[model samples]
Target: MKFTSLLKAATTVAFASVLIACGNSSSSSSSVTEVEFFSQKPEMQATLQEIVDDYNKSQDEVKVKLTSVPDAGTVLKTRIANGEAPDVINIYPQNADFKGWAADGQFVDLTDESDILGNLNEGAAEAYAVDSKIYNVPLTTNVSGIYYNKDAFDKLGIEVPKSLAEFQDIVKKIKDDGQTPFAEALGDPWTVNGFAQLAWIQSASSPQAANDYLRFSDKGAIKSDEVSKNVAAYLDLLAGNGQSNSDGALYADTVAVFSEGKALMMANGSWALTVIKQQKPDFEVGFFPMPGLTADAPTMTVGAADMAVSISAESKNVDASKDFVKYLSSTEAMQKYYDVDGSPTSVKGIDTEGKFEELADVADLAFTDQQAIWLHSEWTSEEIFWDVNVSYIKNKDLTAYTDALNTFFDTMK
Candidate 1:
């Protein structure tokens, strides 16, 4: 079954109108206006509710009715089809094709609110824009890189790798020293494929090569050879490091391995820092850019707006939603979001302080050096890109990789 269909089947309807006491103040003369919010991540739901509670306590004009939808993509789609969707939605670019949805007139054009939009990263704003109009407020941004167990590396006497060849050598050394070199969550196609695609980009002759391959244009196809080579290199790394489980590693399993210190390195986004720190508070963890296969690539990494808030075009309380979005983009809310969520900032000029310092440093490097490429799922079909990568990882064959790319591009044409 298609992933979308599976998600639809798994989704459950939840309706609630209970009011919580936070910091919101209610006035006797103001009428209560309820707006629903749908979110997939439990942590995101909690953070958002806290924000809503604070907002509600500040005023009586608007009350947010938040709902936790585990299968947000499916539930949102169904709601849209039935014309019963929430007033405001948190849409992951991976799940919802922002361009297609905007073209179909599904979102409210947020161009009029340039004051808030101007605070976001230009690339992010463009990604969520259609026909020169922005439709969503970027909440947070995240970048992917190598997260290594410093203690394990020290114990094994293996140095941090600077190049793809050196990376392979380090993994081999770790394995020889009786440690797992890498951890891969193969059961979740997205997680497994992330490694392959990221490796491909990092191995490219130039960052433009990776960009072209993602767009799948004619020029992209020719430049994509480096991508294929990178995939092959990744497969070799997994096979040699004893990281590819025959049963296939699930996302939870991969996290467990890393948390338990069984693996030395894992490639993931900076958002994972909180969980890792919580699980093993004293575990010495260090991060580095994924090493390049060729020196010319210069350590390319992937990043994107972690989440986006879009007002429903069909919202009865458009002004209320707009107000909420503006508040969400404000310095105060963005600061609170960074404090609680630990994600890199999308809005400029916020004080990062001591929160996720490693991630913040890496993010600054990527942004300033122009070494960051937004993750493919941010602008492409997740089903095609993710599935192709997972298949290549499992099979260790290049045929599927080539075929998948050809098929994806053909569909686009």
Candidate 2:
């Protein structure tokens, strides 16, 4: 027999034997189909495991074992190449790599799975959709906005600024008071790139401008008056008012600096909330949209489903894997996962109230008028982002940076 035929026959026999055992068994314990679940975010490991444990207890037919890795993208890709990918994989939809996998038929087509598809926020789910097919289900979402030290604002008699002008004034006052205005984690170019994304979103004149900002080729694309000027201005302000060592500090160090009351504000996302609280539980905090051209520029913010869950196309136990996926995508399970993980859910009509004020402040905007694409997730190469943004930061030259960006994407085209 051909190798493919032999493999298919063996898989069928194994699946049939497991079904037979499950059908015939009458004991308290029966044969359990195990699915290997691989998670990319180390921070969510414990929460994921708890959810997995609940799913296991709810049903005896399938058991899911989750393994969390810090470098999830690299590890997951290597596993897939080796024909050893996990049965259930948790990854970020923002990642361009996911598109490659989806196009290559590595993921099970979940378009018809209404139980999973119906519960999702349509826009959020669309981020991971390829050719109108839902390849993965969203797990939870994160908000990106400005995190401010409420205590610092109170002590300095500074109300939360409402406009870009007001925000700049506050930064100036904070600086005049001998405090760093923004605790930038520039040691990690990715974190710096986060600021770029925030700037691009806040400065966008409209959703069209924001969406088109990522297109590297159109004539005068990156240099458009609203997007480029505002982004450059924001970076310039950060460079001037940030920590003395802001350019040298890693993301963790910025967290520490903010927690210790050394900086009054930090440009971060909801993902950093847990670490900040853990670093200093009583470090009073609040959030607001990135103040646009005026305090009135729509008060836009960036947010989306952070990670997604998908089943492998080549799994031996597709039925069991779907069961596990369904459990994770449920409202109850996702809420538990988010409660422990401290991120808002990507599912519509799910109650995320009173979870984090940072999330609550932008709840209306995150779901409505101010959605922004996470360029980091869409950018095909990290090298392009790091090189362009980092160089911009060091030289403070917008033209050079835009030129380099176009040059890179031009090569890809």
Candidate 3:
């Protein structure tokens, strides 16, 4: 929400302000080490800031200040390229960029931080490891799938779809009932980007097929491919049956629409759980992975480490940064984050009993052999595709979409 909230803010502050603030942290008073903390999860900005404020107030040895902004990922790359890495930051270990960053010595190697790593659930930190070497404190896991309004479904005598055809029939039924079938977050390109990622994952026949979908070596291959066409057609179907103002619907708007029963289902990740709870919908939200093409095989979940903590290897305030990371990994701090996030805690000793029961079906397939992770988890220049996904949804032009992919692929090679 911090990211979306910043989009329409009356007062304007840019990511550069963060670099400017942290840039001066080291040169400031020598009484305490200044840990410049950068955050990627804008939705968790307030909680993280509170944790930092508490840490700073509790001691004089280290002072940690956090910065979170819209499009934090791009801002981070810019800061890192400017040679101004934050002392403390969040890094996705499952990401290709994080792997490259660690290999290039951008993060403090934590493979040897046994004590700190020991605080995490078994295989939690290791699951996102780069070449079997831990590099960050993975806090929570995320899974992507369909979130349906149970009360609406029950009223219609609709069961969760087990196959793509069943899902299509349900969509038709909802449309016939004069209701929007899906609350699409098309207005928010980033939200739609996640939506498109799930579509691609659901369209694939195999894990390699999912990966190969983007591994195009030619320009027209995407437009010519049957599976790719299905992915695009599926987007068109959802957008076609989406809310009337879907083009202007932000992530919050789509969630609000779904919460109010204006739509039957919403495609999103586990993070949407908190937003739905905030709305206090009359219906219980039910989650299901994207159905298989024909029930012969169900689609695997696509997810990765949700909130991961790391310290920059090049931090001038190394000790303070490490201290901040240690505080974040502590049981007390972890509990606070989990309270608001409600994500499956990857940290040890955090009680999450019945915390995300609605997401149990997704959890059953997540982080297992049934999981495919995110397509971008291994791509060097994947974020660029977000705009392409947005473009496809708006224009439904297969040529333009494939053209963008071809250009993006050219850069990858």
- For candidate 1, write residues 1-413 as lDDT tens digits: 69988676555321111222221334433568777776655677777788878888878788887788676778888888898868888875433465677778888888878777877766656654667887877677667777788787787777766678888888778877877877777667766554655675765554456656655456225323646767578667765353657237776677667877878887777777777776763577777776677545466556666667788899998888877777777777778777877776677767788767657535665443444545454344556777776676667667656767677765554
- Clashes by residue pair, model 2: 163-295
Off by over 4 Å in 2: 1-30, 206-208, 211-216, 219-226, 281-283, 348-351, 367-369
TM-score, candidate 2, is 0.85
Best TM-score among the predictions, by candidate number: 2
Tens-digit per-residue lDDT, 248-315, candidate 3 = 78999999999998998988888888888899998888998877677887666777887888888888
In candidate 2, what are the lDDT values of residues 1-413, reduced to their tens digit?
69999999999999999988877775434568889999877877887889889999998789888888767788889999988889988876667778888888998998888777777776667666887888888767677777788878898899876777887788889988988888777777776655677677777675456546665446444553556777777777676666788778898998888888888888878788888888864667887777777855677677666767888998988889888887787887888776777666666565667776655675456545575657556556756676577667778887897777667655544
What value of lDDT does candidate 1 attain over all alpha carbons? 0.69
Q: TM-score of each candidate?
A: 0.80, 0.85, 0.78
Show pairs that collide, candidate 1: 23-57, 24-56, 24-57, 24-58, 25-57
TM-score of 1: 0.80
- Candidate 3 residue runs with Cα over 4 Å from true position: 1-34, 53-75, 94-97, 216-220, 316-320, 363-365, 380-384, 387-404
